[model samples]
Structures are given as C-alpha cells and as structure tokens.
Target: MCCLISAGGLNLIQLQKWNQAAVAKLCWDLAHKEDKLWIKWIHTYYIKDQQLGDCVIPQQASWMTKKILASRYIMLQSYLPSPQHQSMIRTFYLQLIGDLPRVQWKCLKFGNKARPKACFVMWLCLQQRLLTADRLLKWDIEASPTCVMCQQDPESHEHLFVTCTVAKTLWAKVLRWSNNQLCIATTWNEFVQWGISSAKGKAQQAQLFKMVFAECTYALWTERNQRLFESTSRHVDQLAKDLAVICTVRVPPGLQTLIHSFQF
Candidate 1:
C-alpha cells in the first residue's frame, strides 16, 4: 500500500481506557472478515497489510473510505483484541458514550427501572428545558403566561414540576405510597437535592423513589399537554390512580407493595 508512517499516536494501551484500544483492535481486524467481498477487496487493494491506524490515506481514496479510516482518532497503536473477556466491547462502548460529568441521579436516569419514554421526559425535566408556558411566551408563541396546573403563577419548570398544586399533590401521593420520609419536602429543587444526596443507595425504596419520580414527571407532562392541546383533563386523583397501575406494572415484584398501597 502507498502510505506514510504515522506521527506517533501509538502509546501503551491500558485496560482502564479500553475504549481507545478496542477501536484499534477492530481496525486491525478489518482485513480478516472473509464473509464480506467488498471489505476483502479494500483490504487487498488499499490496505495491503499496512498498519491501519497510522497509515496515510491514498489521494484516490473515496470520501467514505477516508471517513471509515478516521476511526484512527480513537484507535491505539499496536493494540490487539483479546478473547479474555466477552464484555470488554460493551464495557468499552459504555465508557465511550458515558464520558460525562458523573452525577448522583445517573442511576435514576439509567439504572432505575423506569420506562424509556418516562426517562426521556425526566431528562428534559432535569435540564429544565421542557416547553413550559413561560418558555413558549419568551419565544413569542401565543401561550398563556400562567401555570397550567395551578393557573396561579407563570408556568415555568419550577412551578409546573415543583410547586404547582397539582404537582405537589401528585408527588405527595407518590412519595407517601413509597413510604419515604422525603414526602415531607415539596419542590423540584428539593427533590433534585434529595436525588443528589439519597438516591445513591441501591435499596428497593431508593429505586422506587427514582422510578416514581420519573413516572410522575411523565404523567404530569402528559396531563399538561392534555389540558393545553386536547382541552381535556383528568383529575389529579385519577392521574394518581393511573400512575398506580403504571408503577405496578413497571416496578419489580418487591416494589409492587408500594404501588398497591397507593391510596389517593
């Protein structure tokens, strides 16, 4: 292959940083997949046993070819894949995508057994980026400047998710059902601080707290949409009952006791 030597991205690979090393190993294996005819052609005509990560791209290489080879940014020099652990690839992938600042609610976000849709809403709630009325009005959209849940204050993330009468009632019911002491506190910021301080435990109640938190956000947001767009609404009690069924279905058997005991 016509190529130039690399500029020393090669370094000793560490098991701790397997995300980089694994990519290098996969690039090393590009020529070995015998089932693919096109890949074999590329291997024979373009690569020809040249070190894949550090080699220069041919001027005639297609844009797609150059793009494909750009995996070298993550590839460690001289790294080779091992059969030592089957989970290494998955571990590497999680590490690759999870390179974010660690937060306490991460377990609630990912490890809590909430539904995917609920978790997505919970993410938006955490970022306070939900399209509440205040945000819509700021964007010059013709939206009510009052809270939909209470109609007493501007509908912002803090009011809608935290202090509104509807939200306070729903979270009180949900938290009380979980038999958590946290039911005493009412506010989104308080709950967020609670997640930061207490949600780190792996206990069943802790998991239940996280699951119901996300579930309640999903329910409240759905209720808000129903009132705003559909011009239909359910009572907060009905929302609680719906969440009871949902929590019963979403939670594990041990946590069902909590959901089953949801009285209001």
Candidate 2:
C-alpha cells in the first residue's frame, strides 16, 4: 500500500493521467463547477468504495495539495470569497497568483520600487506596451516612425528612452550632477542593470535610485507622448532641470542629504 501511494505521488508530479483512471471521469461542464469539485477529487482519489478492502488515508490531504486545488477554483471566478473566509484565503490566493507573472520579470526588479504612476509607465515600457511610433509602424499604422523627441533616427524603446539626443542630454546632466562619470546606457535593459549596480549595497540609496530612475522614465515617456499627440515638447535643459526638481520633491525625508545632489 505504501508503494502504491508513492507511485501515485510520482504519477501526480509527472502529470500522468493515472489518477483519472481510479474512478469514472466526470464530464467537463460538471467538473468545472466549484460547489462539489473538491468532493469529486476526494472521492476519485481517496474513496474507492467500489473496491472491497481498499482504504485511503485521510492524512494525505496535505496543505500543499489543497492550496493547488484552491488556486485553480479561485482563479476561475471573478467574485471575491465570502467575508468570513476572505481574511483566511486572501494572502494565499494573492501570493499564488502574484507569483505566476513574476517569473517573466525576474531580470527586471525595478517595478513597485517607486511612485505608483511612474512605476506603472516604467512597467508598461518594460513589457513593450508603449505603442511608440516604431511599434505603430510595425502594426501597419501608416505613421512616420522617426523619434518624436529627436526627429532623427527611427524611434524605438531604446532610442526614445535612452539613445535619443535629448534623452542622452538628460542622463548626462543627471550623472554629472551626481558626480558620476558613468556613460548613459544605450538600451533599456542595460540602463536598468546600470542603475541596479550603481545603487547596490545601501538600502536608502537603492530606493532613491529606483525612484529617480522611474521618474525619469515616466517624464521621458510623457514627453514623448505629448510630442506625438499634442505637438509640444520641453528642451533638454528644461527637462533635465524639471527631472532634478521632481526627484528632489519625491526623495524621502530621511534621505534628504542626497537631495541636493540631484539639483543642478
């Protein structure tokens, strides 16, 4: 019996269909209904009433196994769980669902580290959802694909945010003011890597860097959109000064010492 249970565990891990063979398979529509699916899984896997002398141990109902089942059911419904059970299940389901997409962004840790609105735009930029002119042209939108900010090279995630002449000016100014001689990165990923490395070790500086980086990206993207849609823009010097002021205002009170470093 122990060997059979071990085999069953291995089969489940391997995603084998052996468990379904233990009982008659239910139809799809009925299987998806939430009210009694738990009961069905229990009966199919643990209650072999049809076979004489077969007894499944109730002790095998482990928390991990139950969590997997609960996650499946909870995700299928849009409505929240009842008030009484909300607190108990909230953290489990949230962590379970939240962890799903994080694997895709393991290399990008800048999200959720700064102001929400700015972080939101930066997140969208990381996901390549900005719909810049270059992207629009790829979708056959029949628009000029040149960088709206520089109006020189074809616009892209890298060019508009990093390599554009205007953008390069902003970064150069910021780096100079901070007394750092590091050159501005040419690509978005490289920029993120540089920011992470530059601010490593000190927690306050790391958070400050994240906020400033996110704000800069947000300002740049907003400037791009306004250029595209509103036909207005800021000069590189004014934009850089605005970035410094924005960063100064957003800096935490405890980290006020470094706030002057951002001001021109």
Candidate 3:
C-alpha cells in the first residue's frame, strides 16, 4: 500500500485496482461481509487515494486544521499545558484596563484599523526586542538599569514609555498638539486598553489617537536605540518632532484638513 501510494505512476485503472485491493484487505481484516461488499462497491467507481499524499484536499479540510495540527505536533512538545496559569496572567493583564478595544477582543493580527499598536507591541514582545531596564541590567548593557530621564529605580516598558517624567512630558506635548485630553496610565496594559477603548464615537479623535500612539511608540523606541547604541542623551524635543513628523505622514489628508480646521 505504501509503495503504491509513493510510486505516483498509477493511472485511473491502476488506481482503482490498488484501492480495491487495499479496501478488500481492510474489509477482510474487519471481518464484516456487508462492510467489505460496500467498500468494494464504493472503490469500483471512486478510486480512493488516487492522488494519495501528493495534493491536499482543501474542500474537505477545515480552515483551522493546519494550525491545530501544527500546534499539536510542534508547540505541545515545547510549551507545557498551563491553561490555568496562562488564564491567570491574562486576567491580571486585563484587569489594568476598564475596557478592551474590539480589535483586541477579536484577537486580530496587528496593523488592522482596530488595534495597530497592540499588534506592534505583541510583535516586539514576542521578538524580545523591547528593552526594559531590568533586561539592560541583566545583559550588563549599563551599570544600572535606572531610568536616565527620571533617575528612577528600574525602567520597564510601562515605566519608560508611560510613567517616566520625560515620557510623561512628551505625551503631554503630543496631547496638547492633538488637542486631546487623556488620563495618563501608569501601566503599559492600561495605556494599551485606553488606546483601544477611548475615542469610540468620533472618527477624527480615533484617527488622531492611532496616529499619535504610533508616533509616540516609534519615537520612544528610536530614542532608546540611540541612547543604547551611541551613549547619547535623551532629547525630548527631537522625540516630539519625530512624533509630529510621523503623525503628519500617517494621517490622511482629509483628517489633516479636519485637524487644521479645528485648530483654526
């Protein structure tokens, strides 16, 4: 059977012959005369395993079958089954936010209109690219992992991007420029959820929020890279300017016109 399947030269008649032989053997093994007869009849017209493993039958397969198969075969071996622990972690993370954005709720891949920043953050986190002061200390990148801008104990994603004084000031400037009023979040999760949930009604406000969020994240990351690589000092003005340029470039012309009109 294996050789017949692997040989690949079987035409319709040959395929039918092979299938009948296989099914007859299976039926004899099963010891069901009716089932054996049914199998023989079925294989008479419908040559089973004609293409064998050469082609995938998309019509007969489920959409998630591949993911399920891969996950079972691959991930199950490496990642232990800890559903309770993972659930606890996810719950703890979600507790920081009042409401989750619809995009996040749906678990859609990042860069969609709904949760672009969430997607980017997920990618960064998965890639281990995010530089926390703890990570810097552990890697011996610096003598201390203390935040340079605030001189705080440790600079984490939450602290450096959202809670640090320099970050706060930069966000303040950005908010002022965009004419938005937002309560500063102390946690990364909270800030993300806020970005997702806030500005639910006004399309303009939502667009501005997305643009500003993307800009701020890019600027903060850029500044961190410069400081880490070149031993350069943090520059809030440059960060702000970079953010402005990012927003200007990303925001659509219609929205830009609306923003300009609002300013006037």
Candidate 4:
C-alpha cells in the first residue's frame, strides 16, 4: 500500500484501509443503538474519494475540501471550553438564527456622556442581568420579592426600572426638567426603545438624553441598594435631584449650559 508523508512528517494511510465493520462495531460498543445516529451522520458526510488509487493519501486541500477540513479543524482546535471558543459558537449560532428584534438591544452603552460605571450598570439592566430582587430570588438568594423603591409591587427589572410609582415620578420630573415631551415606558424593553426613539434631532440632544437616562438608571439602582443594605431611603424628589446632579457633573460643556438652566 502507498503512503504519503504529510507536512507534519506523519505517514498517512489512505481511506481504503479503514475497516467499516470495525468502525460500526466500535460505535455500537460505545453506546446504545438509539445513540448511533451521530455515527451514521459522520459516515454519510465524510465519504472518501473513490477516484483516488487504493492507499494513496491526498497531499493538499483544494477549495472543495477546505470547508470539509476547516470544520474538523475548528472542532479540534478547542479541546477545552473557553471564552474564545464560546464566542465563536455564539457568533455561529446568531448567524444561523439571524438578528433579534431592534428593541432587544437598543440601549447605548458607549460613546455617550454617562459615567463608565453607570453605563455598565445600565447596560446590565438592559440585558436583564442586573441583580434585581426578582433575579436574586430566582437565584435562591435571600432578598425580598417586593420592590424596594416603591414597596407596592413585585420587584423586577421592568417594575423597578420603569413601571414603579417612584420610577415613573422620577422620569416625569426628569423629562419635564430636560424639556423633553416623550412618554414614559412601562417595561424595560419599551423603556430602551423609548430612549432610542425619543432622542431625535441633533446629535448633542440625543447624547445628552442618553447621559441623563444612564445616570438616572445608575442612581436609582444605587439608591435601591442603599435602602436594602443600609436601611435608608430617599424620596422620589430627592432621587430625581440626585440623578440631575449626576447628569450635570457628567454632561459635556455644550450640554452644561442647558443642564444649568434646569432647576433641581
């Protein structure tokens, strides 16, 4: 039988020598009959080149063979689970399934006037990964299921961030103070969509709106944590003033003039 020396200097035997019955027996011996479909799939897609002379190994990959080899190459490259490999799989899955809805990811996390920590917290809130009381309860952590800000509704991403009386009141004061006529949203997703759609016109206005929105989200969360851990609470008006102060400190010089115009 002919043998080819590959680039790695390994003598490779051609496909003709593979014992089909031995492979089938190996598959059967490894698992039950119900689990052998994968073995069948591998055999079906991995057909050997019948045109090649017996025992003659192919020396190089052609365009037709590149994809076939690349798939196996990628699987071999990541023997252990890792962030890079997980990201590659996530990208592949997203490409296969197509894009999600616009409202699913409308929150801006970067390129705005919000503080970096505030942006990150707001981003997590948008992603529904923020440790809201509901999320904590779901994780079996010790937390009250009721909203800390309002104490009138079940605590959740939506209720705490948008629909709570405290949140709604704070938003009303903020919108009126900023000279924005946009409507308040009742859910986290809708809030994100509103934040994206309401800030129209010049880039400066949009950026200032985002900065204010992020600061509000961050301040609300911090206030909630303070209430939870320190047994302290701030009134809705006070929380709104805190949010305004944060926005004033973070806004650009161009926006500082308008921010100065608003009374806290």
Candidate 5:
C-alpha cells in the first residue's frame, strides 16, 4: 500500500525504491561474492557459466530467484557498480530511483513541527486535488457549486482557503495571533508562497510560522467538513483560538516561548 509521505516531516522508505535497491544488491553479490552459497547455486543452476543478461529467468525458478534474475536487464542498463565497494550499491540504487524535482511547498508540508495530517491536507491543497465544488461538478456529481462558507463563489481550493469570508476572517485572526497582522494572502498561490518565502532559513519566526500554517490549513478543512457533513460550524474567532491552542501544544519549547510572547 502506498502511504502518504513528504520530503521532510516524516521519513519513510518507499517500498518500490527499496525493492529496486535490494535487486541491485543481488547483482552486486553475483559479480563480487563468488564464495556465497546463493551465488554459487545460481551459477551452477540457472547461469551455467554465462553472463547475467544472457541468461533468462527459468519458468521453474523460485519466486525470489526469479525476482533477482528479473533485475538483470535493469542492472545492465546502468554502469555496473564497483566490485565489493559500498558506493557501488548506493550508486545503483540512486540510478534506479532517479532524480525527481520537489514541489515548491515541500519543506512547509513536511516541516518538523507540522502535523502529518495537516501536512497531508496542505499537500492536497498544493496539488489542487481536494474534492472542492468545482471538481465534484466536473465529475458530473450533483453538488452545490457555491462556497459553503461564503455561498458567493464557486467552491475551490483557492476560495475555500483564501477568498471565502470565513476563511479571510479566520486568517486575519490567526495572522494577528501569530503577530503577522499585516501579512495578507488573497490568492491560494500567495498563501503558499507566504509560507515558503517568509520561512527562510531556520529563523524562530519561520519555524513558528510553518507550525502555525499547518495548523491553520488543517483547522480550516475540519471546519468545512463539519459545516457540510455535521451541519455545525465554528466562528472564525474560535478557529483562531483553537489554532493557537493546537500550535501551543505542537511547537517545540523554543517556538512555544516565541508564540506565548505574542500579544493575543
């Protein structure tokens, strides 16, 4: 199962990449460790004194053996790693994984203090993959096209998080509580960029902002769900207060001290 993950917040091994790495290890062992029993067996049985790529996977081979042999083509594509060298396997692994570009909001989405659920929501928001009214209607699903909070514009990631009246009020209160009263974000892009540009380096304000930003996104989404599914809603002021309480608990001691000093 593919679990939700990010570039920074929580580190986890991608199973697919890890499997590729394991296969690369097998290739390395075949080339270097002739003394190994498994390698000896492969040479005696399937390989029969032939190159790895020349030998095809036998139909009757064990599942694990087939798995290892299956990687022969892939292993041959890259320059083979050095014999018995640690960097050899790592080089192959990196080659197999390839270099993928990161999203602009990666650090913010996976910050150390950011809650994983909130970070996941932020990820959806950044990808514009949330089930907003625009997406639902496009899918031919019968749903109101208007923003539930303001009921004035089409519900979308942009409106729900930035331009909705409830959202703007909540953001205002939150920014004030975070001692960033002058900061304003009218568009979704601005909201994301604010988090990225403001949180430059490991400044205390930056860390606190990342923590606060995560909590705000999570709380706003929760409020939207409650209003839609439960027919209940929190006032913007309450959301701001609740965000403060959550951040107080989530941030490290240094950030807690920084937040507590802000005038409510």
Candidate 6:
C-alpha cells in the first residue's frame, strides 16, 4: 500500500479505487473464518423452512456468500480509515474551488480555476508558509516581521500582495495602461473581493488587466527569489518591463495587435 501511494504516478481516481480494494481485503480477512457458521445458519433456517433439497443448498449458500460480501463492503466503507488519503482529497477540493472572496472572473480562463502556480502560492499563504523580509534577510531569529516592500510593521499575505509600495506601483501601472478606475485594497481578503466585484468590460482593456495581474505576480516572485538567492536587486521599471513582455506574449492575437500599436 505504501509503495502504491509513494509511486506518485496514479491519479486520484486510481488511488481511491486502490484504497477501496485494500479496505475490502481487510474486511474479508476479518470475516472469512465465520463463513462456515454463516452457511450453517442459512441452511438450518432458509433451506429447511423452504423444504429445499441438497441441490438447492449450493445455490442458497452462494447467495448467502454474496450477501455477506456486500455487508462487509459497507462496513469497510463506514470505517473512517485512511485519514491521510482523506486529507489529500480535501486539499484537492480546496485548490479547485480556491479560498476567500473568490476571484472567479480572473480564473475563468483556467477552466473556472486559478492557474496551478497561483493556486499553489495562495495555498502556501493560507498555510502560513511565507516569512517576512527581515527574517529572510537577517536570518533574524526574531523581528517584527515587516514586509520588504513597504517596510510597514509585520508582513502578511495582504501586505505583500496589495498594501506594499511595490504592489501599489504595479496596480497603478495596470490602471493607467488599461485606462480604468480601481479602488486600492489594503488586505488580501479585500483585494480578492474587489477582483470578484470590479467592473470588467468584455473588451481588450479588461483582458489586458487580467494578463497584467498574472504577469506582475510572476515577476514579483521572480524578483523576490533573485534578491533572496542571488543577492541581486532590480528597479521597478525593469520588473514592470519584464512583466509587460510576459503579458505581451500571452495576450490573444487581437489584443496583441492593440498593444503593439502603443509606442512603448
């Protein structure tokens, strides 16, 4: 069973079927020794009353075996075993639906879900896997944990994504380029809510904003990694230009034509 799970190749449906079979095997082992007793009782009660002869005994016994097998199947299902497998199932569902405020509009292109990378980062934030800039820099055993971007005390998902100066700059550029009005959000929850509720015209500009948001997020993480691992720094213009190049590559042909018309 461990080997099957550790193979890392089977999909969810395959894993579920494998677990069901395992459970059934365990149930059958527990009940196998009682098979004779069950057959005896069936013979004494079901066959004698019905006046069935010896030939019918085999048929009746086969029927009883099937009944007992089904009963064991149900028992196995109800056992509440495999907690680790259950947790994996739940995590899969959570990632599929996403969390908090719900940015379904932006995720529509991904088959009504966020991109895998975006979903993974969001899950990490939900699980509190990220550390503050000071901790990242000082290897600080302890600190107020302010964000590197804004340096306002105590970093968190909200601060890093929406409230930081770097994030604000990115948002401003998006608004300016798309020629749209946007309300700044101070918290992660609020940003997600705004993403869901904000007016998104079915036009090139609206589509551009979607690309901009995804590209900026990818670029921001790239910059963060560079700073952490390579001891390198980047100007905001450079980051934005990188993001623009990525967005240009991903934009639909119609939108790409519009973007190309710009002097920048």
Q: Against the true structure, whose TM-score is highest?
A: 5
How many backbone overlaps does candidate 1 show?
A: 0
Tens digits of per-residue lDDT for model 2 on 57-98? 355766644433433433334244553675424423343333
What's the CA error at residue 63 for candidate 3, in Å? 23
State the C-alpha lDDT per candidate. 0.68, 0.59, 0.52, 0.62, 0.75, 0.51
Q: What is the C-alpha RMSD of each candidate to the true structure, in Å?
A: 9.0, 12.3, 16.2, 15.9, 3.9, 11.1
Model 6: lDDT equals 0.51
Candidate achieving higher lDDT, 1 or 5? 5
Task: Give the Cα error of residue 199 in candidate 3, in Å.
Answer: 5.6
Query: Per-residue CA lDDT of candidate 4, range 1-264, in tens?
Result: 122211111123333322322232333222223356654443344434332112232345344333333343233332334534654443333333334334323435435578878876776677678898888898899989998778789999898878988778888888777777555576667787887675544566677787777888888888889988999988878877777877888787887777788775
Candidate 1: segments with Cα more than 4 A from true spot: 1-26, 30-73, 77-98, 183-188, 257-264
Q: Which stretches of candidate 2 lie over 4 Å from their true place?
A: 1-87, 94-114, 179-181, 199-202, 261-263
In order of TM-score, best first, we have: 5, 1, 2, 4, 3, 6
Candidate 3 stretches with Cα past 4 Å from truth are 1-129, 136-143, 199-202, 262-264
Residues 1-264 of candidate 6 have per-residue lDDT tens digits of: 111111221123446444544544433443333356654565465444442222133444465444444435344334343655665333333333233343243331222122446434443443335564544556746544655555454566566667778877876765555454664787777776565444265666656655555555555665666765687878877776765665566667777787775443
lDDT measured at residue 66 in model 1 versus the true structure, 0 to 100: 63
Clashing pairs in 3: none
Following a full C-alpha superposition, what root-mean-square deviation does model 1 have from the true structure?
A: 9.0
Per-residue C-alpha lDDT of model 1 across residues 11-102, encoded as one tens digit per residue: 23344546454653455446345567767876777878787655687778877566556655553423334646545454444434444344
Candidate 5 structure quality by residue, lDDT tens digits, 1-264 = 122233322335567876777786787678668999989998899889678878778888898888888876666776764545656556666666655554567667545487778877776776788898899999999988888787688899989988888888887888888876344788878877877886656888878777777778888888888888899988888888888887888888777778889776
In candidate 5 the C-alpha lDDT for residue 262 amounts to 77
lDDT of 3 by residue, 1-264 (tens): 111111221112335434333333342322223356644543343324442222233444344332222222222122323544654222322222214223341211222232355436533532335867678778878655777667764777777777888888888887777777764788777776666575444467766766566567656666766776678865787677666665665666667785664331
Q: How does each model score on TM-score?
A: 0.70, 0.60, 0.52, 0.58, 0.79, 0.51
Best by lDDT: 5
- Global fold similarity of model 3 (TM-score): 0.52
